[model samples]
Target: MIKVVAAVIRRGQKILICRRPEGKNLAGYWEFAGGKVEEGESKRQALVRECREELGITLSVGAEIFRAVHDYPQYSVDISFFDCTICEGQPVAKEHSRIEWVGADELKDYQFCPADGDLIEILSRGQSGI
Candidate 1:
């Protein structure tokens, strides 16, 4: 299974979502900002590293908001989404095709990865839980 961490960088009514770069799995699909959790590191550590590497920002990881296990033909994924606050630097699309601050109501406008289906539903319903 691939262990992954994602960030829900909530700012008022909007949350940060990123598009996978072309040529990558799930390319062109929208998803949260995070990456695979590396071996020997806690999920939080990996998330911090990912935010810096992918978004060029420092993060103050907050409470975990969601978790799901999804199966793909090639592999299985365990993804956790956490509420996060940016400590420094603005988000840049260093590794993604683009980045957007989308309102929960508009989340459905973008195609997201299957692993994010449940969380997307939750956000669409109302993000009070997160």
Candidate 2:
């Protein structure tokens, strides 16, 4: 399984979401910006690095909000989601096709990855039990 870390970055009433670049895996799907956890790195470390690399922002990692094990025909992912706060820089779609700060109610308009759809529902309902 591929271990990955994603940040659910919230600023007041908005949450950051990004669309995967075309030609990438799961292209065009909306997701919280993140990437694979490198060997010997902790989830938090990987998350911080990924946020910096993908979104051009630094993050203060918060609590683990969710975990999902998603299986695809080609591979599988063990994804860890965390609540996060921006520490420096603004979000830029360095790795994504687009980025948006969307309100919880507007989340349904975007097509998210299956695992991320579950997380978005949890967030939209103001329940982060996972």
Global lDDT scores for all candidate models: 0.93, 0.91
Clashing residue pair totals per candidate (backbone < 3 A) = 0, 0
**For residues 1-130, could you state the per-residue lDDT of candidate 2 as single tens digits?**
9998999998998999999989998899999988899999999999999999998899999999889999988999999999999999999999999999999888989999887877888787876453
Quote each prediction's TM-score: 0.97, 0.95
Runs in model 1 lying further than 4 Å from the true structure: none
Q: Which candidate is the best by TM-score?
A: 1
| Cα misplacement distance, residue 55 of candidate 2 (Å) | 1.2
lDDT of 1: 0.93
Residue-level lDDT tens digits of model 1 in 43-128:
99999999999999999999999999999999999999999989999999999999999899999889999999999999998857
Model 1 TM-score relative to the real fold: 0.97
- Model 2: per-residue Cα lDDT at residue 77: 93
Per-residue lDDT, model 1, residue 125, is 85
